[model samples]
Target chain A: MRYAMVIDTLKCVGCSDCVVACQTENDVPVGYCRDWITETVDGSYPNVVLELKSERCNHCENAPCVRCCPTGASHIIDGGIVLVTPNECIGCGACIESCPYDARYSHPEGGYVDKCTFCNHRLEKGQLPACVSVCPTNCMYFGDLDNPNSKVSRLLKNRKYKTLAPEAGTKPQVYYLI
Target chain B: MQEEIFVSGRDIPNIDPSLEIWHWPIGLYLFLGGLAAGIILFASIVVILNKEDEYPTTVKYASIIPPIALVIGLIALIYDLKNPLYSWQLYTTIRIESPMSWGAWVLLIVTPLSFLWVFSYFSELFPTWDLKFEWLKKFEQFVKKNRKNMAYLLVPLSIILGVYTGILLSAFNARPLWNNAILGPLFLTSGLSTGAAAIILLAKTAQERHLFGKVDLALIIIELGLIIHMLMGMYAGSEVQLEAMRLLVGGEFTVLFFGFVVILGLIIPGILEALEIKGYKVPVAIPALLVLIGGLIFRFVMVEAGQITRYLY
Candidate 1:
């Protein structure tokens, strides 16, 4: 079954609880964020709307990062999660550049490129991702997208959704309810 | 709210003050790889065109330099990696879609082929003790045949390596500045020019060899045309791409773009070539040196400029 996350922007108060939770859980380095929010201001200051997008690895069906990795360091797991094998990575940074979402980064100490692995360890234990579990507003939803009865699948069917950078043709597993 | 927008989860911020390690090494690797590929291409052309006899010293030195440069370039690339030990995995696992993977494969195959080619070309310089062993004779004959094939095979391979360097950057569609389709051709053309200039300078001074005047003149003209096309293509592209032209022409990279790439790399070399064609004696070393410098600077400016301009708002 395909796994996916649906974020509700209306409910998201631009709180970064998700970012903090992911970092603390994964032991991600400082300054280099695995998940973060980007704020865009539309129109002039007086008439502006602050658009906040929490970005991370899209876990694309046709991931360019996977395609650009020379040593097969970047791979898609059985559950459609894009993961990096640190031991096989030569730190070429080609995958980092190829990712359209700008989701990846070169690890400071390791030097190998890294991104969110959908909290694979947690998934194996049948636990929700840190971001999903900690989100106070109940804005983030994660479940089996392929299972018709799953929360994410039902939400996708009921709500109008949009994927980031649709032009990239990456078939991102992350969907957003605008 | 302000704290959340840009706050670190860990008490200590993870700012790597130094830019990524891959930056310098990758740049050096691309430059040297292009140079080596160009040199090999130039030498093969001379051999195939039956002009090697006239420029024996040039072909000899050119062939020798590529293997050395290839070794250096490969080392620089591997040294910058986070896990240097894992570099050997590149050879074992082959991925066709990745340009980096393709480069690793190319380098592996080309390194030994290049050595064999150069060794066979200079076999006469080594003392030949004919061993009566049939197997040894057969091995020698096989090497000789392989060398001939290498000479012919490397022409396309060199072009591929040269162009692949440009394609590496162009593959990044998010970076509109580097996504131009013309990058491949422009890189291939510049590689040839730089490669030719390097050989010409080295052969004339280091090896005391002279090239056929007509051939030198012809190459210069072709190189000039390619540079013009490359510049024109960049200028005519989208505003984001035109930013590259601006950086070169009136922007921060002006000195490097006009002073080094255009004037020293193309203009001076073109003028000297013209003078030679006009029956005027011009020192070949001067123009050749300028050409080599120009090529190096072109790569430096292009790479630096591409990185500095960011569209991320």
Candidate 2:
């Protein structure tokens, strides 16, 4: 089952609760982040609009990081979750460099690349991603996109949405509902 | 109607400096690896054609470059990795689609093969090397007996090695500056030109130096054309692609790209060769050195600029 996330921008409050939750849950270092929000200003002063986009690892179908990685450290496992094998990782940073989304960060302690893992540790215990479970605005929807009955799939079916950098041809799994 | 909005990631710039992963080590590795590949390619071609007598001094001296340079490049590559201690993981499983995987295996094969090629040449240059080690003498004999066959084998390997240097960068589709298909051939040409330049500087005989000088000038012209085409490709692409063009043509890297690479690396060297061709016999080593240094800076600029490319803002 291809797990995916659908974020509704209209409902998002730009509160950054998910960011803090992700950091605390993942034990991310001080200088690094697993997920964050992008805020942009549009139009001139009179008609100005602030657009906020929450983003993280796209978990692309054709991941550049995976393709460029020299070692088998960055590999796709069951459920199409792209994970890094820390022990096997040579810390060449090829994956970190190649990722278009800047999803991966070089960990100060481990020296290996780290990124949003869909909260795999929590997932194994049948729990939602930290960011999704903790988002106060209820803007995040995470489920199996491959299943038409899944919440994410149903939301995608009913909503008008966008994805980042479609031209990059990464086929991102994250969807942004307008 | 749709309103044009300034787009940004939740917390990222188009090019995030804080997320930079590759550094000087990678740039040096690319430069050295390309240099080694270029030397091996040139030497193997000269040796395989049995033109050793014509390029007598070059045959002995130039042939030694690949082994030495490859060793150094490998060391740089090893140290560049964050987990240098876990480098064995690169070989434990081969990912056919990964350029880095191919690089690991290719370097493994090319290093020792090049060392053997250099060993074969050393015996001819310094016979005393054989007196010290019986194994060395025996290995040298084996290499001498099959020198032509070895030369032929190295031809493809060296070319692949040279091309891989560029392929490594180009494989990163995320970095529009490095995603060009022309990067492979462009880097290959650059490396070979530097290799030729090195020969011009090292060859003891006037004729050999002159010949390599001529070769380098031709390579410089080709390199210039490729650079232009590469920039044009980026400029003519999508908005992000055009932004990539700014890095090389008129952005932060403008001076480095045009001043050092175009003027000092290509044009000045061409002018130097023109004087030599006109019987002026201007210093060849100077231009040769410029080309080599230019090659190094080329890798540096590419790596640095590529990280700061416009994408996924």
Candidate 3:
């Protein structure tokens, strides 16, 4: 089954509680991030529009990081959870550079690339990703995209959404509904 | 009402410098690797043309460069990694699609082959200079026997190494400045130009020096074309791509890009080499020196500028 993340940009209010939860759950080091926010201002003068964008790994179907990794450290596994095998990571930074979203970080202590993993550690326990669970706005949704009955599939059927850098040909699984 | 959307990484409104993921070590590694590859490529061609004996400085000096440069480059690369110890894993598995994989294999192949190429030169140079060690003699004999096959092997691998220097960056879709298709050929030409300039500086024979001077001039002209093509392509790209090009054209690195890389690296050196080719007197060493410095500065600027940019704000 193909897993997906749907973020409702209209509902997000720039709160970074998800970021905090992600850091704490993963034991991420200070001054580094596995996922972060992108706050952008569009329009001008009286009609300005500001967007709080929580950006992270897209887990693209055609992942460039997977292609450019010399070793098998960066790989896509079941349900399309793109992950880094820390023990095997040579810390070459190829996967980090290959990501268009700037979603991956070179872990300071581990010397390997790290990014949002759908909280796979939590997923195995049949739980929501840390970000989705902590998001106070209820703006984040996760489900198996291949399952027509899943919430994510219903949301896509009901709304318009877009993916980042579609021209990159990565086919990102994350969707943002405005 | 008018509308505009701008992307900036000004994360947390920080006045402090943003965190850098890769630094000088990676830049230095790319520079040194490119320089060594350029030399090996040119030297392999010389040997294939049966001009090795005629251009002793080009053969001897050039052969030694790859081993030294590749060793230092590999060290810098490992040192840049967060876990330097895990680099050993690069050898056990190969991902054919990854430029880094190609890089790992290229280094493994070219390093030892280049060392033996140097030893092959030792057999030729030692007897004439009347200097010899027993093991060197024996090693040189083996190298001489296999030299032809080795040169054939080095020629393509050196080209791969040279192009890979740029491919390593271009493979990264995250950094728009480096993601251009022209980067591969542009870097290869730059490597060749600087490689020829380096040989010109060390060649003892006037004929060998003049030949390399001409070669360097041609490479510089081609490099100029490639650089322009790369810039123009980026300027026509998406908003983010245009912003990336601005870093080189009108941003922090503008002076370094237009002033150093364009004028000193290509223009001045190109004029000097042209004059010398026309039978006019001009010191080759100065332009050769500038080209080397320019080659280094180009890599440094590209690496740093690429890192300063991001896809989100």
Candidate 4:
């Protein structure tokens, strides 16, 4: 099943709970995060539009990171989640440079590139991703996109959505509903 | 009319405003690797042309460069690796689509070949030195006999290694500055130019110096043309591509790119070499040195600036 995350920019409060949840759940270093909040303001003087998004790895269908990784460290797994094998990674950072989303980061301790795994370890135990489960506003939706009845599929089918860097042709699994 | 972006909890180093994944060491690796590839390419050409006796620097003396340069370059590369101990994993599998994988494999094959190429010429270089073992002496004979065939192998592999330097950068589609296809030929041409310059620097005969001076001048012209062509393509590309070009043309890297790489590296050397070719009393070392330095600065600028140009905020 192709897993996907649908974030509602209109509902997100820019609270950054997902950022903290991801860090605590994944044991991400203090200065690093698997997901974060982004606020974009567009317009002039009196007219303005602000869009807040919780951004992370898109787990793209045509992931450049997976393709560019020399040692096969960055790869896609079941459900389209991109994961890094820390032991296999030579810490070359090629995948980091290839990612359009700037999702991956070089782990300082292990010397391997690391990024969001959709909380795959938790997913195996039938738990929602940390970011989604802890998001106070419930703006984040995660489920199988392959199942038409899933929350992600319903959101995409019913609402207007967009993906980050669509021009990159990565076919990112992460979707944002505005 | 304007757009402002702000992010909270995005304090991720090297990924917040822009990426700073690659640093000086990567630039150094690319430079030395390209230099080694160029030396091997030219050395192979000199061997294939049967000019070993006339151009000892190009064929014999220069033969010593690739092995040493590659070893040092690899050292720089390994040092830059976050997990340098895992560097051996590069040989486990061959990812055809990955330029780095291609480079790793090519280096594995070419490094030893470069050492062997140098070893085959040891007797001529040092008459007093002797291979005491029969097997070692026989292997040397085999290498000596197949020197031309080795050149044939080296010619294509060196070209691959040369182009791979650029291809490695270009393969990263996420970085607009490095995504262009021209980088392959551009880097290859620059490598060849630097290679020619190195030969000129080491050449003892006026004939060899003048011949390579002319060759370096030609390569410099082509490299200039490619640079202009690359900028033109970037100018006509998407918004991000324009921003990427601005990093070189009018942004922070402008001085480094135009001053060191363009003017000092190409134009001055081109002019000096041209004057030298025209029978003017010019020191060949001056232009050769400039070309080499320019080549190195070009790589540094590309790596540093390319990392700053990204698809996202």
Relative to the unseen true structure, what is the C-alpha lDDT of residue A18 in candidate 4, on a scale of 0 to 100?
A: 91
Q: Highest lDDT: which candidate? A: 4
Question: B33-119 in candidate 2: lDDT tens per residue?
Answer: 888887887777888878888887556787788788888888888787777888888888888888889988999999998888777
Off by over 4 Å in 3: B1-19, B123-136, B310-313
- 1 against 3, candidate with superior TM-score: 3
Say which docking band candidate 2 falls in: medium
Give the alpha carbon lDDT tens digit for every residue of B81-183 in model 3: 7767888888998778888887988899998888888877774556566435777668777888887788788889989998998998888777778888999
The model with the greatest TM-score is 4
lDDT of 4 by residue, B16-133 (tens): 6334777888888888888888889988998999988888888888778889989999988998888888988889999998999989999998999999999889889878988889
Interface RMSD of 4: 2.1
Which of 1 and 3 is the better model by DockQ? 3
Per-residue lDDT of candidate 2, residues A71-99 (tens digit): 77888877778899899888988887788
Q: How many clashes in each structure?
A: 1, 4, 0, 0
For A61-137, candidate 1 gives per-residue lDDT tens digits of 99988988889989998989999999888887777667767677778788677889889999999999999899999
True contacts kept of 1: 0.41
* Candidate ranking (lDDT, best to worst): 4, 2, 3, 1
What's the CA error at residue B235 for candidate 4, in Å? 0.6
Evaluation by TM-score, superior candidate among 2 and 4: 4
Which candidate number maximizes DockQ?
A: 4
Q: Residue A88 in model 4: shift from native, Å?
A: 0.4
- Candidate 1 local lDDT, B205-227, one digit each (tens): 42232343344456556656766
| Residue B177 lDDT, candidate 2, scale 0-100 | 92
Q: Show the colliding residue pairs in model 1.
A: A30-B14
Ranking, TM-score, top scorer first: 4, 2, 3, 1
